[model samples]
Target: MSDPHIISAAVQEQRAAIVSQRDFENLYKQYAPFLLRVCQALCHDENLAADMMQEVFCSIWDRRTTISVKGSWENYLYRCAKYQYYNHQRSLSRFRTVQDSVFAASDESDDSTQEHIEYRELTHNVNQLVEQLPDQCRKVYQMSRGEGLNTAEISKELSLSEKTVKNHLTKALGFLRRNIEALFAFIFLIS
Candidate 1:
């Protein structure tokens, strides 16, 4: 091989005309083997390495018409290859990171499903407790809490006075609080 600095200097001085077809062919012959080896080291596939090497040569050929070099051609080729490899690895890492994040989100969805099941069980228990209330109290409680109605709205719906609605709510709340306290104590003892 000729001196890399002299080759680069010649290419730079002559520009398009100096980088003739023969010169391009020689450069490909001289550098393709080493460039492919570099690509293989980075990509770990012979076919991919060959493809990347071909791309590198094509890029260099396209830029040969205008590209100027101030240093050794060998160094420039290696640097370009190294940058391409780094960019490839960086993109691969980003894809892996996104995949990992999606996997983690899937796990969270599983946790959310378990939480929803537990919530449904709790709602069922509370619904059973509500059913045990006096019919009028249950109706008033449902009307007040479920529909987000005011005492006046509940009063109107049940044909009861506001004071009667308040009395039903108070009794229902007292019964629920006492029952819940006793249930908690029983659970603690059982556990």
Candidate 2:
């Protein structure tokens, strides 16, 4: 691999100009492998590392208009990759927490075996309902209820207004409540 500083300098010089697709491709060719290695080290999965790299590049492209290269583009790219990696880990952690809570709640019931099965089913149904939500609403709900983040935190993290975050949460809860009611009615009818 050539010196990263050389590539970084080239990118920095062109940072103020409009990034053409050719420039973006050149940047990707130079940085993707390095960023992939960073992601793979954090995730320990090749496919996930590649996905993360793609996401990072996509993010860069999306925010290209306002992007400012301060010190080193290499460092900035690594920071973006690291942030994405931690975000993925946080999502996984939240999922595991949900599973653990479901088991714990079920275990406390008198009919543990039956309760466990019911709890699993309820969790599955809730997950499906969440997946059906619009992208922003689903993300807000996950960051709030799933990761236990406050509305202000979610707003900052997602670059949304606090009111927007509240609206998404409200929308998600309303959708979930309606679906859950229907699901319960169907279950009762079947049982």
Point to the candidate with the largest lDDT. Answer: 2
Lowest-scoring 10 consecutive residues by lDDT in candidate 2? 182-191
lDDT of 2 at 174: 61
Where in model 1 is the C-alpha error above 4 Å?
1-11, 14-22, 42-44, 110-191
**Cα lDDT of model 2 by residue, 30-113, tens digit:** 998899899999889986786678778877887767777777668988999999888767756655665576567566777867
Q: Give the distance in Å from residue 124's predicted Cα in candidate 2 to where it truly belongs.
A: 9.5
Candidate 1 per-residue C-alpha lDDT over 1-191 given as tens digits, one digit per residue, 9 for 90 to 100:
78999887776675433267788888888887889788898789875565556567767877876766556667777877887677656645655665566467567677877657756876787788889999999998888788899899999988999977876775666556546555544534553
lDDT of 2 at 38: 92
- The TM-score obtained by model 2 is 0.50
Among all windows of ten consecutive residues in candidate 1, which has the lowest summed lDDT? 182-191
